[model samples]
Every structure is written in structure tokens, then in C-alpha cells.
Target chain A: MPTIWVYAEIDNGKLDPSSLELATKARELGDVEAVVLGPGATEAAARLGEYGAEIVYASDDQVYADYVAQPHVHALTELIGENAPDMILFAMNYDSRDIAGRLSARLGSTLMSNVLEIESVERAKTAIIGGTIIVDVALEGAPKILLARAKSFVAEPLEGGEATVVPVETTVPEEAKRAKRVERHEEAATGPKLEDAPVVLSGGRGLQGPDNFKHLEDLASAIGNTAVGATRAVVDAGWVPYSYQIGQTGKTVKPSVYIAFGVSGATQHIVGMKGAKRIIAINKDEEAPIFQISDLGVVGDALKIIPQLIEEVKSRKG
Target chain B: MNIAVCVKHIPDPNVPPQMDGKYLKREGIQGVLDPGDEFGVEAGLLLKEAHGGEVTLVSMGPAAAQEAIRRGLSMGADKGVLVTDDTLKGADALVTARVLAAAIKKAGQFDLVVAGVESTDGYTGTMPGSLAELLDLPQVTFAKTIEVTDGTVKVNRQTAEGYHVVECSLPALLTVTAGVNEPRYASFKGIMAAKKKPVETWSVADLGLAGEDVAIKQDVAGQTPAEERKAGEVITDDGSAAKRIADFLQEAKVI
Candidate 1:
């Protein structure tokens, strides 16, 4: 079987769910193994094993105990040299992209980023030119690096299967330790994460003002498990934080249910959330292009419609 | 306190391109500097203002890429370098990174190398990290705010979770995201001054690279226009849009 190695990022003793999804997808391609890095790699192995990893290379080294790119790149470079895996999959994240890109340069190999689908060991597909075209690319090299887009695969557990965990033994060079993480300013997030939330409620310029976003917050709270998002127009207008922006320049989200309120759905906005399983757009303009891609298009004033929708949803929940 | 900013020339993002069968047709499309790279230019200029150093713009593309260098010059960059050769026609991300690393090294010592998180056209988002590794420099990717002090650089990096403050010694690399700073428009005076600014053109040979060293590693097997989503169910407002939406949500089983 072709050996596939997945780079799993661990934080606070937990394996990122997106990495598990990558591991789950790797099973179909070949015999899958996971290489977890950082302080909690050892603790994360068991969880990764449950997601169909055949082997887990857990590195609980102090050199990588913090968030830095060079050390991880050095560790992965050594692992690729030792294992000679045919392909390595990295979950699309900051650290994974950093390490994968660096390792590809070190090894003179091909690194494919934002891959949407994998056709085979040799060929993969990614969106290019601002999501206007899909290109099937064949990478010619050993240890092909694929950075799978986040949420491209579902994390399916393989019950009753356990992976053999092996501690990774590698030394981080002195030069690799130059960069240090000083502090992390974590956002005071209380609700579901935009990417993790199954239901997303996003507002646009039609919401009128920043204060009007409170209605979206009410609807989201009423829905219980929804994350609030915003369009570029609203974000540019200073109605929302950059973190709340969803578009070509913002967060790319693929929720199970996406509700767009007052969003005219520019191509920039649509490219970010088009992967929603069910897209529901609420727009006052019936001629809006958002209705073209929406699974359910509701033509009405959001101000008049959202309050009633919230009441209806609350009553249903009651 | 010398900095190098990597910029790219791409087809204008505003105009939807006419496809050349399986690839983007570039013959008639106006090529502008990649929008994302403007942030890099702006950051580099800001760094220069703070640290009192020169910002050298670098790019790897066809001869037309000089347009991007001129634009950067017009935006207050000091000098520019263009690396172009026929062999680099289909270069992939890794190859591009290697060539850029070489060009940066050839341009001499730089305290920092700044680039866009990804090019608007390719969107690989990996070249800066690759370039850093090739040059053996510390990298801070997706930085929102960058500060250079006492031979070190600090940045606030954007992440899926939130943000992190990262610090690295000088002679490092940083890839910036959009919204990091407001890019300045090229002024008439600046545009005129750009004509006098020196832009050096180099080939693969100048960087001690050959056709094989920078050959593209990925082959395009085929291409397809992006899949268009169809309007599945469109209903006008009959004073029951909310109820209809609720029922549709229930039927879709997403509630």
C-alpha cells in the first residue's frame, strides 16, 4: 500500500478535528499514518488513532512545545527522510502550510495548496485564479505534499481500530529555534466557531448599521448552535470585525446550513461560503445574484422578515 | 534594516478572463500587480519609514512583471529586481520559491523579506514559507502587524482561532495578509519619480540556476471552469417567506 503521512497539529492536548478529517481521508488513498507535533502530541495520538490512522508518530519535544514553524519543518524533514512516505497530507492551517511549504523547498518537491479533491497519488485538484477555475494538477515527485482545504472531508471514526503509537526522536537545530511566540491574544469567543458551527447566520450591508447586527445575534442565539458571519461590504463599512467577514478575502466556511441575511452575494462573498450543504439567502432584491446559487431564496426586507423568523424558530424550539 | 518585498503581476482581477481552452488567456487582459501583494509593498514601506532603510522590490515572472516593480517604485520603494527566463513559464510554487530565494540572496543581505500570503492568480499561499526555508530564515506567516526593533521582528499573526504575537530575530521573512494596512495609492509625483528609479533585470543565469534547477514540478493534466451552483428553489415573498424557509430547513434536515 502507498504510505500516506499526515501532519497533525496539536494544541492543549487535543488533536485538531480538521487533522482527524485529513487522516480519515488519507485512509482511502493508502495506509495512513499521523505525525503529531508539539507539547500534547503524545496525548493526541489516541484520538488520532480512532480516526483510522495506522501508525502515530507522536513528538512531545520541548523544542516544539510552543508555536514556531522552523522546528516543525526540521522535524518533518527528518521524518520524510526516514520514512520515505509516498505522500504527506497537511490540514490547511497556519502551521501546516508553514511547515509543508518549507519542507517542500528543502526537499525540492511539489507542494499543492488548497486542494479541494484528490484524484489519485499523482494527481490532485485545487481552485486557482481567485476561485474562477479548477485545475487538475499532476505532481511529479516523491513524498508529494498536499494541503487539503479545511472541511473538505468529514471526520469519520473507525471504531475498534487502534493505531500503534511511536514516539518521534529528532533534534531541532539551534537556528530553527530563533523565532519565538511571545503571546497569543485569543478572541473572547462564546458561541460556536464559524467553521465548526453547522448553521451560520451572516449579515450584509442591508442590515443598515452595526447595531442592526443584534438581530442576527438574536436569531443565532435562538438557533442555539449558529455562528454569525458578515459580508465584505459590511466589514469594509466597519460594521463587523475582520474575523466575522466571510468572502474571498475572509474566512472560507462550509457549514451544513448557511443563512445569508441582506447579502447580495457578490462572487467574492459566494466563493467563501458556497460549499454550504444548504444555502438560504434572504434578500430584498429578487434580482440579486445570491438567489442564483441559493437552495432556498427568500425575497423580502430582512428587517421585516428576520424578527418573525426568530419568533418562528423560538416557538418551534419551545 | 534592508527589506525585500516580493510582488507579482497578474491578470486584472476585475475582468473575468476569456479562457484559452484549458488555461487563462492572457494576451489582451491588462496585467496589474496582484492586489494582495500591495499590502507587502505597504508593509515594506512602513518598515522602511520606521527603521530608516531601503526597500527593494523583487519579482519572478515574464518581462511584463516590471510593471509591478514600477508600481512598487511608485509606492515609495527604493529599487527593484526582476528575475525572468523562458524556462520558468510553468514553474510551480516550490520552483518559484527557490528562484526567489536565489534572487533575494543574489540581491545581497536583507534584514527582512515580505510577501503576500498568496498570489491572487495562483493562490498557493505557500511560497513565502518555502522561500524562508530555502534561505534558512525564520518566517512569520499571515502577520497582521509587524514591528522591527533591536535586530528582531515582532508580528501579530492571524490564525483560525484568533491571533498570536510572534517574535523573531532579524534576517527573517514575513508574509502579510490583506487588511493588515491601508496601501497607499501611487501619487503623480511618485509615479514620475519611479521613472528615475533603478530596476535591474536578471535571468536564471544571474541567480546561478539552470533550466532543470527551476523546472516546474507539477503538470496540469486538465482544467475545468469552476462548478456553478444552480438556483435550486426560488420563491417570491408571498408574506410567508419565513414559514417557507422554516419548512425548507426542516425538509433539508439541517435544523
Candidate 2:
């Protein structure tokens, strides 16, 4: 079997769910190994093993957290040079993309991003043109670098023992420590996260104005497990925070149900939510492209329909 | 402060894309400067206006890519350098970065490099990071705000939760988000002045790269249509539209 290494990420003393998802998928492909860095590497390594990572290369270095991506890149480059795995899978996020890009440049290897599925170690599948077409791509070089999109695979833990934790040692050059992250400002958020929510209610310019988002919030509250989302246009208009934006550049959500209000369904926005199990779009324009993929499309003013829908839902529950 | 801005000329996003076998058909489609890169151009121009230096646009695409460069020039940039060659037809992100690094080196010594968070067409969002690595420069991606003083660059880097205050020294690279600043339209006078700005076009050979050096590392085995989500029911909203939707939701067991 080919060897596959998963670049694992840690969040709040736990392994990031996306990393675990990649590790779970990697187990099906080959012998699963992992490389995790930062403050919680030791703890995360144990969890990674439960998700099918047999051997974990870990470094609990504070420098990985203090600086940007270079330290991790330096350490990973050295590790890959020492033990060349057939393929390395990365989660599509800020630090992963940063390290993957640098590693691909340093190794002179091809890197594929936004991968949706791994057909095999030699081939992968990706969506292009706003998720309208799926392309099967051949992985040409050894040590294939693939950045898998979030929510592509389900993470399942196996009944496994502790992995062999190997410490990663590399001298981080002074040049690599140039970019320093001084402070982090986490936006105050409540309710469920947009990505993890089962149902999502999204808005766009057709919502009329920013103040109308309160209606969406009210509906989400009534829906119980629903989260609010917005299109790039609405986010760019400052109607919502960047965290609430769902599209190509924003978060990709595969909720069980996605209900869009006034979203004209730009290709960028469609790509993010196309994987949703059911899509319901409401727009005034009958010709909006969103209707093409929507399971149920409504043509009318969102402003008039929202209040009535909210009432209807509340009355039925009562 | 001398600034270099990496830009891209892509097929207009407003137009539906057409596929030619494994590749996108580019010859017939209209091309425009990537909208995302406008923020980068605007950021560079704003810095040059304050710091009193030049803003140079660097790009790699077909000969038609000059239009993108000219658009940047018309926005008050100084000049442009475009690397266009047949060898770079299907160049991946790494190859593109290598070529841009070479062309940037040829352009001159720059204290800062700027680009968008991602391109509209490919949207890989990896070029700037790869280029920064190849050039041995510190990189700050997803910058919402940038400030420069005394050879240090400070940025508000956007993240999933919020933003991070990041600092790096000179000779660095940054990818600016759309929220960074408002991009200005080209004034008539600026458009006329752009015609006089010198633009240098170079080939891959001029950048000291052979065909093998930039060989495509991946191939498209085949392309198939994504599983279509069939349209189920459509209705124009009347007074009872909400009732109908609520019933549908109950049937779907989502409510």
C-alpha cells in the first residue's frame, strides 16, 4: 500500500475536524500517517491516531503559533525530504494553503487545490466552473500535494491505540520568522456555526437592505438548528460579517437544507452551497440562474414572503 | 517605497465559461482584468501616492493580457511587464509563481509586492504564497488593511473568526481582500496617459526557463457533469405561498 501523510491542524487543544476528515479518508487510500504542529500537537496526535493515523510526527512548538506559515513549512519540508511519502493531504484553510503553496514551490512539485474526492493516489476529482462540471485529474509527480476542500469527507474515529509519536526537529531560519501575528481578534458569534449547522438561511441584495437581516435571524431562530448566511454581494455591502459569507472565497456549506432569500445565485455563490442536500431559492426575477439547480424555486418579493413564512412555521409548531 | 503588484487577466466572470476538452476555451471569450486584483492595484497606487514611489504591474497571460496591464496603468500605475509564451499555456500555480518571481526580479528591486487574495477565474489562491516562497519574502495573505512605515508593513489579516494583526519587514508580499479599499475608476486623462506608459513583454525563454522547467505536472483525465439537482417544484408567490412552503417543509420533515 502507498503511504499517505495528512497535514493535521489543531484548534483549541483538539484536532481540527477537517484534519480528522482527511485522516479518515486517507486511511481508505493507504497507510495513514500524520504531521501535526503547534501548541496542542501531543494531544492532537492521540486523536489523529484514533482517526486512522498510525504514526504521528508532532512538534509542540509555540513558534508555529507565534509566527505565520513559514515555520511549519520549514519543518514539513525537512520531514518530507527525510521520508518521502507518496502523497500528502491538506485541509483547505488559511495556514494549510500557505504551507502547501510554499512546500510545492520548494519541492518543485505540482499541487492541486479545492479537491473534492480522492479517486486513488494517482487520481483526484475536483469541481470547476462553479460546481457545474467535475474533472478527474491525474496526479503526475511523486509526493503528490492535494488540498482537500472542507466537508468533503465524513470523519469517523476507529477503535485504535495510541500512535507512535515522533518529534519533528528543524532549525527554523530567522527569515522564516519574519511575519509575526501580534494579536487575534475573534468576532463575537452566537448560535451554531454556519458550516456545522444542519439548515442555513442565506440572504442577498434582494433582501432589500441590511436591516432586513433581522428577519432571517428570526426565521433561523424559529428553525432551531438553522444558521444565517449571506452572499458575497451582501457581505461586500457590509450587511453581514465575512464569517457569514458563503461562496467560493467564503465558507463552503453542505447543510441538509439551504434556503436562499433574494440570492440571484452567482456562480461563485452556487459553488459553495451546491452540495446542499436540498436548495430552495426565493427571488423576484424568474430568470435568476439559481433556479436552475434549486429543488424548489419561488418567484416573488422576499420581503413579503418572509414574514408570512415565519408566521406559518411558528403557527404549525404551536 | 517601490511596489510590485501581481495582476491577472481572466475571462470575464459575467460570461458563461465554455470547456474545450480538458481546458477552458479562451480565444472567443471576452477578457478583463480580474476584479479581485483591482483592490491590489488600488492599494499599491494609494501607497505610492503617499510614499512617493512607483507602482509596477506584473502579469502572465496571452498577448491580450496587455489589456489588463493597460487597465492597471490607466488607474495611475507607472508601467507593466507581461510574460507571454506558448510554453506557459497550461502552467500550474507553481510554474506561474516561478515565472512571476523571475519577471519581478527583472523588473527591479521592490520593497513590497501586492496581489489579490485569489483570482476570479482559477481561484486557486496559491500564487502569491508560492511566489513569496520562491522569492524568499515574508507573506501576509488576506489583508484587509495595510500600513507601511520605516521599512515595516503592518496588516490586518482576515481569518475565519475575525482578523489578526500581523507585522513583517520590508521586501515582503501581501494578498489584499476585497474589503481593503475602494478601487478607483480610470479617469479620461489617466486613460490617455496610460497609452504613453511603456509596457515590456517577455517570453519564458527571456526569463531563463526551458519547456521542461515549466512542464505541466498534472493532466485532466476526463470531465463529467456534476450530478444535477433536479428542479422539483416552482411557483409564483401569491397570498398562500407561505402555506404551501410550510406544507412542503413538513413533508420533507425539515421543520
The most accurate candidate by TM-score is: 2
- Name model 1 segments beyond 4 Å from true: A129-132, A204-209, A231-252, A262-272, A282-292, A297-318, B225-227, B232-255
Query: Model 1: clashing residue pairs?
Result: none
* Model 2, span B1-255: residue lDDT tens: 899999999998888888866887655579899999999999999999989899999999989999999999999999999999977877788899999999999999999999997788887877888899989999988887899999899998877767789999998998898878889999999999999999999999999888656888988889999887785678898887788778867876878
DockQ of each: 0.59, 0.73
Candidate 1 chain A TM-score vs. reference chain A:
0.86
Question: What overall lDDT goes with each candidate model?
Answer: 0.84, 0.88
List the pairs of residues colliding in candidate 2: none
lDDT of 1 at B111: 91
Writing each residue's lDDT as its tens digit, candidate 2 over A72-109 gives 88999899889889999998787788889988888888
